[model samples]
Target: MRRLGDLEAEIMDRLWTWDRPATVREIVDDLNRTRPLAYTTVMTVADILHRKGMLRREKSGRAWSYRPACTREAYSAALMRDVLGESPNPGGALAHLVEQLTPEELAALRSALDSVDRGAPGDGPR
Candidate 1:
């Protein structure tokens, strides 16, 4: 997946957190509460995200409604995989990531691995 720009990340964050489809106008209004942003600018970024397959869009009256194509966790996992793939020492990189994890996170990772080992779902890692 292509990395999101500042605006794209902000929009995706809202969609993921809201867990619902939203129009550009709604997003622009929400964003304006924290920072000034134009409706057209957000519409353009949302279109880009749709083109990148990061977001799904549909017509909502005269406007387009957008939602993330994948869950945040899935998107994050793909990003991690991409980073690891780019590393010359993927194992070392992974080890370094593990080393940085908190105790609870480490335990969750271990549990997720164990679950995978048992042919169970790997939902415990996150």
Candidate 2:
């Protein structure tokens, strides 16, 4: 998937944070508090996101309500997968990633790996 533009990322961040479908007006109002943005601009960018399959929208009254097509965690995981795919040695890249993890994160990773090794239900493959 293509990376989002600045405005697109900002809009997506808002949608993810809101955790609910939102109309153009609602997004524009919230964003305008941080930086001046026209409603038309926000609406146009939202339509672009929908076209890119990054957002899903439904008609609400006279307007469209939009929400993320995927959750933030899913999107982040995809980005990480993309980066890993680009490495000359994916295993080494993953090792480098592990080296950088915080203690809590490392513990969580260990627990997940252990679950996978034990063939735990709902854990799936690592």
Best by lDDT: 2
What's model 1's overall lDDT?
0.83
Lowest lDDT block of 10, candidate 1 = 91-100
Residue-level lDDT tens digits of model 1 in 25-125: 99999999998888888898999999999999999899999999999999789876665554545555445343345789878878768756564464444
lDDT of 1 at 77: 96
Judged by whole-model lDDT over C-alpha atoms, candidate 2 comes out at 0.85
- Mind giving the per-residue lDDT tens digits that candidate 2 earns over 1-126? 232378899999999998999999999999899889999988999999999999999999999999999999998898776665555345554443433467899778778787565766666545
All models: lDDT?
A: 0.83, 0.85
Task: List the candidates' TM-scores in order.
Answer: 0.63, 0.64
List RMSD in Å for every model shown. Answer: 10.6, 10.8
